[model samples]
Target chain A: MVEVQALSKSYVGRTVLDGVSLSAPQGAIFGVIGPRGAGKTTLLKILATLVAPTAGDAFVAGASVVSEPLRVRRQVGYLPNDFGVYPDQTCAEYVEFFAACYGVPARERAALAADLLQLVDLYHRKDTPADRLTPAMRYRLGIARVLAHDPRVLLLDELTAGLDPRARVEARELLKELSSMGKTILLTAPNLAEVQDLCTHAAILHAGQITQAGPFDEVLATTPPYRTIAVKFLGDVRLAMNLIKAANGVVDVQPFNEPASPSDALAGVTLLKELRVTFDGAYADASVLLRSLMHSGVQVVSFAEEN
Target chain B: MRAPHLKLPALELSPIFAKEMAGRMRSARAYMVLTVYLAIVSGLSVLLYMVSFLGSPRTVSGSGAVGTVVFYFLVGMQVLLASFVAPAFTAGAISLERENKTFDVLRVTLLTPAQIVWAKLISALGFTLLLLFATLPLFSLAFLLGGVEPRELIIALCVVFASALMYALLALYISARSRTTVGATLSTYAIVLGVVIGIPLAALIGSSTVSLALAPTSGSSSPLADLFDTLLTLAISLSPISAIAASQRFFSATGELWTFTPSFTGSGLALTLPSPFLILTGVYLIASVILYMLTVRRVARIEQQ
Candidate 1:
């Protein structure tokens, strides 16, 4: 439903998106993961037809964003990361206004607004002023506003950027429901884990380039099959290193000593130590390794896989 | 293959206009502004009427002069009010959209650039026309008192409306170019003041210099002098205040509200130009169309920036 071909965008002389390309099939939830200022928002804006790419073009729902922007607009519902609400407008009025903007008939707007508000779980607050809504509620209202047109493609930029954990979970569920409705959704996030659980197709964008792209498992398969396990402990560093080095599936161990502080010296306590172990093993083997470390009497503060 | 069927889009009220009007009219501040505007216009009209007719014997013939005084005063007041009010409504029209971060949302919709600009222009102009027309009863009162002609009232109202539109478009143009509402507003007012006050002041100085230069050669006609006269007429016609004054002068002299024929005097040195009201109307209409186009273009190119 969405295809981008070598799209490049530059501001003045600074290139923000450099020859990036990606594609998502119909009804796929595609997540573009990148850190802040990694040109993720620029990519979305180009696809949304709000910004013209300096080179190449993007297409949404088979319409070229450059040559046929209006048609593309008709096929895409874009929710910007930062948007403002009309100060005196109700949530229902806000949705209805966007419906009107999308050329929805006046007679059908009320029902449409009601249905959309219900979809975003904002039906109870339909009459409340939109600006007065909580941030999470407002974010949901934005989703409702974008869906007002019922476009086939949704370009949501950082949909869960500032949401609480519960709200983020709700947003993920909402995206899943939207995907189930056969709507192709393209969303952006600052980390892979935020979207890894929800996205069927994922792309990792960094420094204005796509580093990885495809189905979730295929993208992961392209990377080395090694997990870095971080262990923080307040025990003998040498013994912990030797024990981890001798453990099965342990490939490398790098120890980091926490700087000894005057307070620690006064308390007569051993300094804290952290070890990053690169392990090439199955999930079961990793758990067995942790159990052995615990049984060996080493005080483990944290044991977790990093990426 | 046969040509594809093509049809022009139907005319309808823009959704942006509808939304803006809904928000504007739903606010208590809108009604408060209307009430305050009506109160001031009404009080001023009553005060002007009393100042003209009070402490004097009520004479049937003197009512005409009183009506004339009151009518001009009210018209001038309306012009001044429009100059002040139009910018307040429109100087932030586009900049506020940027400030509120809604510009991209609107752009991404099916609303075309022209539609958005026209919607904004019409919404602001709609409220200004509301304010201008709210004083109609007062205008009718002046007409009933006898000296004000129907044509004069109509012409005066047209001038007020034109001036209001000019001011609104000026502010909107600045708004489209400015990044902040405060900057757009301050720049709009500065330019408006320059047009309203500075142009007339410059015309005065130019007229005096021309008069002084011509005093020595008062008998001969020169193209330079004629050009100066034409430019002076254009400048005076550009300012609403002087446009009103010129209209009054033309009416007092020719007793006509509009004319196409330009007259000359003083061996072609003194220029009795066409009706200043007509000139002002023509200039404003053309300039407004140009400004509208430029604003639309600016807005259309915003995403590129």
Candidate 2:
């Protein structure tokens, strides 16, 4: 579980994060989506207790990241997007070192290292130096490092930003596996499509504020869901508009008006004037309305959705 | 609250110190540095002994003389070594956390700022001391001539010990302040070298001018003369070479126990300066401690707000 209240951070004269508040419950997959410079990384750093916020408070897994950072750290595992490895250290050695730093005992570190490596699918690369690994391998090892201590919550900053398509898919799939284990995952990224199907919940951050957040479908539903269809009437325009208005999903209609056209040309000129219409439900509504209008009396020319 | 299965009472400091040592040990550069240091101490001792041998029967300035040269070489080596290694060690000790983007991970661990600072110091100094120990055989070669006084040896060890600690702490402070190892290393070397090198040069040059100006005066101690004597004595102890030389001169004359007090017999020893070295050591030590505390505070503040 995580809670942030009025969290703000600034460097010099510029504000990076301004009064951003958020909360994630146990086992919830919370996603923070934003464009560049939206303070997504800054917010994650504060939550991970790596960087301090200039003002406000945060708690991670019942421990205050501001006041009880050590406790919070023990409870949370953070995988920074750019967290790197010592080139000379083997994957196993790297994980072992972190385990030691996290206060895992000497006796338990070896096996724990193996287990974590296995979890990240880097078990075969256990003896391989960390720097020699590919970008995807490096990211997987970074994840292994975070899970070495079996933390309660995971804060993944840009978990799939720079990876190629295949690696990105792998990361997403790995996250899905961890989430199934009831891990409270809080991840940040800009690719909505990648996370759209993967994340159960997401927050859209624009200009350093949580503009909209919740289930992606719920947020999309909150916005006006309408299918806009463009139609060129081959026959009488007035007659076509009347027929479309009578269909099941024909909510609204606006006639296409040309600039600097004579009144007579604009009137009764159904060959070129395109009539746009809106429909609720699937895109089939627009097609169904268009066919019904054509079947009645008006000759339909061309019709397409407003992509 | 307890950390499960922690055997080391100072386990918080253990990981940092061990990793510090491991990193340095695995580097060819670290070995190269140690080799250079060993060569300098051995070569300097040989050079100094040759010079002393050429100076007459008085060249055998007794056992204390041996201690003098040993510590003189050690002082120079410690300064050079501290400049080189302290920067590398302390600079990366904290800044590299930022470099690897693991600063957050380290900060979030169940280790407080004080623990982090202490671990950093141990990490830096522990490795430095290991290299120093590796060259102790060369040090003992100076002791072989047998004129070194036990008290002088004790004082030398104490000064080197305190000096190493102070240097380590100072570098850690600089490391904490900077975000990169390069910046921290350069700043640490400059600041520490300035403190350790600057003060002694000022004292030596200042005292020499005063001594030359007062050379015409006779045997009586003017009030001002006594003050200069006290200041000069303090300066000698503050300095590694001067302290060794003064102690050597004192032992070559009267075999009295060395303490902070003075036996104002100028017939045996020309002067006393260990007290001043001790003063400077105290000042530097205090400064180092204050700097380390400030570093810890900076880290804690970064974590808090």
Candidate 3:
């Protein structure tokens, strides 16, 4: 488990993190999302016990980060965005070295290193020099290194950042496996879609402050109720727009960009124009409005939620 | 039933030390440095031997004089080379981690800050010891020629080893505080210059003025003369160069460690007790420990966002 209380950090005259608080339950994957310079990395560092908060405190696995950093470190495995591996050392040697640092006994280090390597699917390449691995392979090796001690909590800062799409998907799969093993994880990413897909809980940080945070479903439910539906019509767009505006639950109507409409590539779909309609009610109301358009003899080429 | 257990102490050699040793020992840089260091010492020793052999009167006693010159030359050369190489080995020890962005991972490990600092310090010193030991055969070669006592050889090694420890710690402290490896490297060299050249030069000038001021005493015994001699000895004893010079004095059977008879009253005053080499080594070892602690503290402070 990880808990942060009123954490704030500043450097010189600039404030980086201010009054940020969140919690991650055991075995849940908690994610942080933000734009560039949103203090996501700073918050992770504070939780990792690598940096002290200017005010407030963090606890990992029931140990206070400020007062019991060594204990906290023992319980937490932090993987920074750009953790480097030592040159000229094989993957197994690198992991075993960290294993020994964590006080894993000599008798067990080899097995643990081999286990982690297999877990990250790098067991076959265990003898390859660390610096010789490709970027994706190196990232997997870093994950293996962090798990040498089998800490209860994992702090991952942008594990998928700068990775290609295939590598990102693979990394997410590995994270899911870790999460299944009862490891509480705190990770950061710039992509909201990725975070929503992988996280059970999440917090959105904007300009050093938590704007919205909660269980994934609760946050998704609380998003703005305003919904826009786009429809590409085959006939006069003005007539279709008027018909949709007159339908029940329709708040407003506006023409959308031509290229954005899906009717551009459809053969025999001449005079195709897109109209966007605003709805303030539930999904049933939008469905009723769609039915009313069909009954009015207006041919709708494509219909979907715009945002 | 639990398996038979063997618990190792938590403070054994850190994984950082093992990792660094594995990488550094395998690198071509280590062997290259060893070769260059031995080559320089060999070249200088042969040149010094030729000069002494050709320039001196050919006699059984001449070999003693030749051995003395060669011994001092080797000591001075090794000390100079060690001073140059010690900082280079350690000044980047931590800063290179920062450059590689690996320090954050290290900081989050269960290893304490002291473990990290000591691991780096010991690894750098181990490499230095390798370099120091590489010259043992050469020193032995000089010993076979004559006139260099085992005690003097031991003392010189102690002085050089102590100097290496001091330089290693100084560079490490800078490495811990610096953000870039290049910056740490430059700062280490600058501070080494201040220790080796700057401090001794200032002390020489200061003590010379004191001696000049007392020169006009005009054949009268005074406590002020003792003060001047003490100041000179203290200044020299604090630096590596003067420490090595004091060892030379011990080998030459001069009044032990800056003791001299006064010109006017036929009395003698010893400026230092025990020995100048001991004083110098003691000061440097204490300072290095203090710096090591400070480095551990400094490294514990994480300063990035």
Best by lDDT: 1
Which candidate achieves the best DockQ against the true structure?
3
Q: Tell me the spans in candidate 2 whose CA falls farther than 4 Å from its real position.
A: A10-14, A53-56, A223-307, B1-13, B47-51, B54-71, B74-84, B211-221, B232-274, B303-305
True contacts kept of each: 0.49, 0.45, 0.50
The lDDT of each candidate is 0.82, 0.72, 0.79
Q: Could you list the chain B TM-scores for each candidate? A: 0.87, 0.76, 0.87
RMSD score of candidate 2 (Å):
13.8
Q: How many times do residue backbones clash in model 3? A: 0
> Each predicted complex: what DockQ?
0.21, 0.20, 0.23
**Which candidate leads in TM-score?**
1
RMSD of each: 9.8, 13.8, 10.7
What are the TM-scores, per candidate, against the unseen true structure? 0.83, 0.76, 0.80
Task: Give lDDT tens digits, candidate 2, residues A223-266.
Answer: 34455677876667778888877777665565654432477567
* lDDT (10s digit) by residue, model 3, range A1-307: 8999999999889999999999999998998866558899999988888788899899888899889888887788888887788776899998888778777777888888888999999999999999999778888998898788888888898867656557878899999999998899999865355566789998878789998788977765764344667787677777787778777656556565433335545754446677766656678877887787788877877888864
* lDDT ranking, best first: 1, 3, 2
Give the CA lDDT, 0 to 100, for residue B268 in model 1: 46
Candidate 3 stretches greater than 4 Å from native:
A224-307, B1-8, B202-226, B250-274
TM-score of 2: 0.76
List the pairs of residues colliding in candidate 3. Answer: none
Rank order by DockQ, top first?
Answer: 3, 1, 2
